[model samples]
Target chain A: MTIRYPNGKKYVPVRTSKSQKLKNPSFSNRGKSLEDELNESNDYYLSRGIAVIHKKPVPVQVVKVSYPARSAARITEAYFGTPSTTDYNGVWKGIYVDFEAKETKIKTSFPLNNIKEHQIQHMQNVTNAGGFAFLIIKFTTLERYFIVPFEMVERKWDRMKAGGRKSITLLEFENTSVEVQPGYIPRLDYLNAVETLMKLYDDKIER
Target chain B: MTIRYPNGKKYVPVRTSKSQKLKNPSFSNRGKSLEDELNESNDYYLSRGIAVIHKKPVPVQVVKVSYPARSAARITEAYFGTPSTTDYNGVWKGIYVDFEAKETKIKTSFPLNNIKEHQIQHMQNVTNAGGFAFLIIKFTTLERYFIVPFEMVERKWDRMKAGGRKSITLLEFENTSVEVQPGYIPRLDYLNAVETLMKLYDDKIER
Candidate 1:
């Protein structure tokens, strides 16, 4: 990288071009995407007596507020707040549950990069605290959803740090995951998956 | 309320005045009012895994938006959307729960006018579907919080509609209420009250 001071002094890069992008890749919802579908599913769950889980609203932090005469306050400067937890967390049947729902079109494997460091840490904390923690990874192109345990994720995460594979393959997903049936009334009746999760939690408790 | 169009004209009471007065009540957090304390208590509840409940953000429907820059969109006009449900709802100990949290300062009684018609209907729906529905009414002047059952609310609502008293007396609040100890976390840890609620719901299910 090169830089110049106000005096017009310039410097050139002595750095390696090892592929790190500064710009954030936008996840645009081109038309109605899986997020929209999940929103509908959430609404369906709320309407029926199945579950009550809501996607947290995009967090906004107001820095400068302007309360003009006879007008609503205008926020001039603000930035997105980093969520300390997963995108969703709720209780069902006395079980404290937390998870991130994701979808990608890649066919062969799911990239470990799709999961963030903070998210992995959050999942670890929840699991350690005797709560159910997992991910809803949906292969968009393949029309498949898998419930992958965070315990499995932790091992893979350590390997990736040690220069191992940077992703979880399709085979691993098929073998170590449970499928959630998407229905009409309660849409993604995830409580069923939660039932399976409860058994795992109970077994852990017993152990 | 009277208004003039482009031409000189007058009208009856406007539909918005009551809503505006209800919403923008000058909430003076003077030396920490009951509302302020409860809000803080709710925050305490959320952080400690005691209960999960939040005041719903006001619903705003944007009519026209101006995109003036890449990252800024200015809303031109927005109206309040009719909220069908109560202010708060969540799960507690494997039991489905929903409730409206309200505050009143009248020393004599809780005004029935403080309870809305649609809210009563929503509570009825929640109760019918095997959920614990309730109200957490804080008498500000008295510094007392009461857990009022939805069944009692339903009966009171019936009386109000039939041209009875516009509110319930302090005696009524005393007779059919569960007192909650005001605390820092889980402000109204109505679980003590939930025990009473659970019995009622469980008996109905057993029948």
Candidate 2:
């Protein structure tokens, strides 16, 4: 299947051979990491004065260490830190933007466990403040992606807690969202999706 | 020495115990640590819903750990991670807030090195998007606290880069900032200082 909208030349991100084993089956275009692609796309957007977006820095936690000999102290103990906030947050054309990018192999639906309680709350707060908040779900197995707003997610999440299915089925997501074309510079051209969400929610403040 | 602020309660947080020696003079609360006081103040502000502020969890790079059969996993090695953002970022009332709190025992001034290049960029981006951005400075030797806006900071920083003095002295900060009277509940009632800054900036978005 071919994408109709964006046709820009993109640089494919190379995947570290170590991580290829964990990637979703059928998705092999792992040339550049998501962070690098997003950074490049953000620079492109920024220089043109089109929109401003940034990828939040990685979160790291360090523990005990030793400096006995005359050499650099070695990190001996540490773990990944949980970000209390989203991975990316910024303003685009006068609108507050907050989003998280995720890759999954499941072809039928996305799992709810990928979303955390604190992140849900953060998105809720963002939407409550009249900000544009959503997630970019990349279905690596199906070679597809969907951009869903908080409102749709809130509905599904509430129903799930009320004894419904734990995950959002592929059918439901496809029926609700518009497809986005993946480009070399921007792995997922999500602004097109944001445009859709903004239209639905009313775009009085957006330029 | 005691000073009353007409609110019918003590303004300064008294020393709980004056006996033990604090090895780190940067923390000059005598018997109390700066982190403790900051936590106490954040809690007070949070409970009243006046503001929601939190310290960004510190970044650590863990390298090795040993599992002890009789107890928890022992962290054997770790090191600090270079954080690209500020120490704290959150919302106060309706205005998005970003800040860094620091203490210096030196009597002359606080070192500019305390503010990292990435952190300055983050603050600049935050403020450019129309949010409240500043740093809280605690000079332990002088027993003074000052809230300096990022705009002023960036200006001074640019000058320093052009072969000027490396830092803003205590005298310069005192002349430019509001001295936040300490409190029992929220040790440093920062929002009060924020309120003053808001009036100066004349931003209508308030709590």
Candidate 3:
């Protein structure tokens, strides 16, 4: 049986045998999207009084709406709008936290084009304004997750703009970014990585 | 001539004589909605590098979309979803800021029903997380704007839930909230009011 998502993409099922799943328990969450994983993790965080982060709703331009029924107003004509900000943002430990989540199947490098120019600009602005901004990138094929700080992203972005490598290699990620471990309760434990990054920056400033 | 909006509400044009406008210059922005005022103010704040605040886009649930052309994907069926969070949120001076903007035509009191239970919960959660949360309320009839801190709002909410008055009176707002004077550049100078509220709370904490 074949299934398709609303975006017209094929929904490929993760075919892991029971024995294989037992060996690789992380494969159990292979079918979930990056967004779903983040949302579930955010929910767990909120419930545990750890953090309060939320993913902003997808933007849409409504041209026409109809009062089909008294209770339900139906939107008839609309189009998606280009988002001006990052996907997820909120407060964590009295500090403003902002990040964009991206997942790529390629294990070699994550393409710079995966993030929009405005999003980079937004992250820079947030960071400049003394807020904590970072990128939560998932290399799906490698099952690796990393939280790259805005300063690192800015340096890479400047390099990309100045005709440097158009992608950040997996080796570069391993060296620069903090890798997140997958977990059961929160799924992707990215906040732990974030805390490590924060401490690393704090130590740098002290030095 | 009658102008009707997409929502079937009549667009009431503010009729002001040139002499009246010259005497009271703020009357020029009488017709602008509270949302328009805030968006313009946010843009001004962004450009001046004062703060990074943004109004979240209206939430919509798209049911069916058609690829009419190769470029433009048209949404044919959708519905407006009840927003889970407040309208405006961003970072200010490394502190997370979150607030809801509401305008009421009632002169006597701002109705408690204007706010949802979940919204109050969200604000409380943000405040508990050490982020600042508040409401920017405009009494349209009185042409008065005030920034009421989430603490005050929580007290009122509890009072209302415990069989007190169903609404907060204008007198109560005058006593407890910080009034915002509208300006030509930012339109509504609510951030100044927010800063005042912050200091006030800080002093209370010190005491």
Candidate whose TM-score is highest: 3
lDDT of 1 at B94: 38
TM-score of each: 0.61, 0.73, 0.87
Which has the higher TM-score value, candidate number 1 or candidate number 3? 3
How well does model 1 score by local distance difference test?
Answer: 0.64
Looking at model 3, what is the TM-score of chain A?
Answer: 0.85
lDDT (tens digit, per residue) of candidate 2 on B1-207: 677779977787443344333223334355555566777887786666665455766556555667878865655776666765676655554456678778877789878887888878867666666656788888865667888877777888898889887888888887776678776667888888978977775453532
Please tell me which predicted candidate would have the highest DockQ against the true structure. Answer: 3
| DockQ, Cα level, model 2 | 0.21
Give the higher-DockQ candidate: 1 or 3.
3
Deviating ranges (above 4 Å) for candidate 2: A1-28, A31-61, A68-70, A79-83, A91-96, A128-132, A202-207, B1-54, B60-79, B202-207
Candidate 3 CA-lDDT value: 0.85
Tens digit per residue, CA lDDT, model 3, B53-155: 9999888999999997576999999999988789999987677889999989788899999999989999988877878999999887677889998888889
Instruction: Tell me which of candidates 2 and 3 scores higher on DockQ.
Output: 3
lDDT tens readout by residue for model 1, B1-207: 557666675544433576444433443322455556656765665466554445544444444555776766555544445566776654344344567877787777888888888889777766665556788887766667788888887888898788877887878877887778766454456667757755743453231
Which pairs of residues have clashing backbones in candidate 3? none
TM-scores of chain A across the candidates, in order, are 0.74, 0.75, 0.85
